[model samples]
Target: MSTSDAVTTQSPALSSEDRSARIAVTVFPLLILAAFAIAMITPDTFKPLAPGVNWALGVIMFGMGLTLTLPDFGLIVKRPLPVLVGVVAQYLIMPLVGWALCYVFGLPDAVAVGVILVGCAPGGTASNVISYLAKADVALSVTMTSISTLLAPLMTPLLTAWLVGNRMPVDGAAMDILLMVLAPVLGGFIVRFVAGKFVEKILPLLPWISVFGICYVLLVVVSGSVNKILTSGALIIAVVICHNLLGYLFG
Candidate 1:
């Protein structure tokens, strides 16, 4: 094929993926709202799925791992400063902003703890997709996500204890991080490293798997708190909006 034909043939696939990523970002928030409504309307329907929540989360993390390659980490060495700054900002600014918002709004302890936990959490894999869609530096996004996730076991737990422990006990934060974040990711990375060619074959399906897993987990979580959500969902949504917006602004 000529050069133009080669470029033309490849462009459609690349553009398709970009388009899908953009659609996902736009659709995710609406999906969350829909999940919440479903939970509130029929709590018992989802409560039975609670036992599967951990497994769903694990699948999501494993999907993240499958998408990763060892070379992705080299971005850290290629541009250390930006990666370091992003990591530091991810860990520092968001937690402080979350803490400040909690106080300013006088959020209930349960809600305050949730906000703090989100702040303490590492950069999510979705950011990589969003970066790709926005034509940002996908490598940098991946590096920041990988580093902060590796650091979550140490940073998330300690930060949660320090910032949120006063309001409530943060027992087993380290354990939670280990089980929820580190183990599955490490397992996925190891599988990818060992079976990269096979992993690549299934890579296109991983994102959809992750989306389904997350949706299931959200359903279970929302079901568990259906009553609270029925009463205070609006306030909770507002707080989440504020937390996310302020976090972006602060970062």
Candidate 2:
């Protein structure tokens, strides 16, 4: 192949959607850092927003749903291997790693329990958007997230009990998870079905909506824990970051 042809094929000019996703991905880390600072500095501000965080998450998931098409799900059947691998790895790796971290850090019982819970929990709602921004397989990400989440009610309780010696009341949170996460996503898909063209027109904007919503979630949740964060936040933050890096490396 010719050099220019090779270059053209290898690095084509980004489409408007690609550009937007790129920009959002670039800004995402800075936004989260800023949100963390704001949350820590004025924790009281986010206290009021706590009640509505689930709604905010639903809105974000709805946006994620809007960006999808029926064909996006074809991969689940056509290529199931990746989905299976992702789900299995997610369930197996993160929980054990969290337990190991808690032990290594000598974390308090409450903090250790929290980490274990997070480990056993399915991927966050923001994962789809993050996956999109990273140019990863969104369909695979969505499917894995859904599968892991559906499995959580059983897996979480068992894993938490084994690791932390305290069983999580998954029965209670199970309904909330469905209503808050899956329901909104389903609603979004329905809307997309009814108005495919309109949804396509607005697809480019979904990443920004997701980014803003997730950042707000971070601030609110972090703000609520400002006291604990301030008291021994450094250790927690360090361990969390280390845990994340390890997950990335292994997963």
Output the number of the lDDT-best candidate: 2
Model 1 regions more than 4 Å off: 1-26, 108-114, 121-170
Candidate 1 to native Cα RMSD, angstroms: 4.3
Residue-level lDDT of model 2, residues 144-227, one tens digit each, is 888888887888889889988865565678667767767888889899999998887887898898899999899899988888
| Best-matching candidate per TM-score | 2
True-vs-predicted CA distance for residue 61, candidate 2, Å: 0.6
- Tens-place lDDT per residue, model 1, 105-218, is 899888888889899988874575456445466557756777787787778878988998763344565466456655776788889999989887776566566656667777
TM-score of every model? 0.76, 0.92
TM value for model 2: 0.92
Every model's Cα RMSD, please?
Answer: 4.3, 2.2
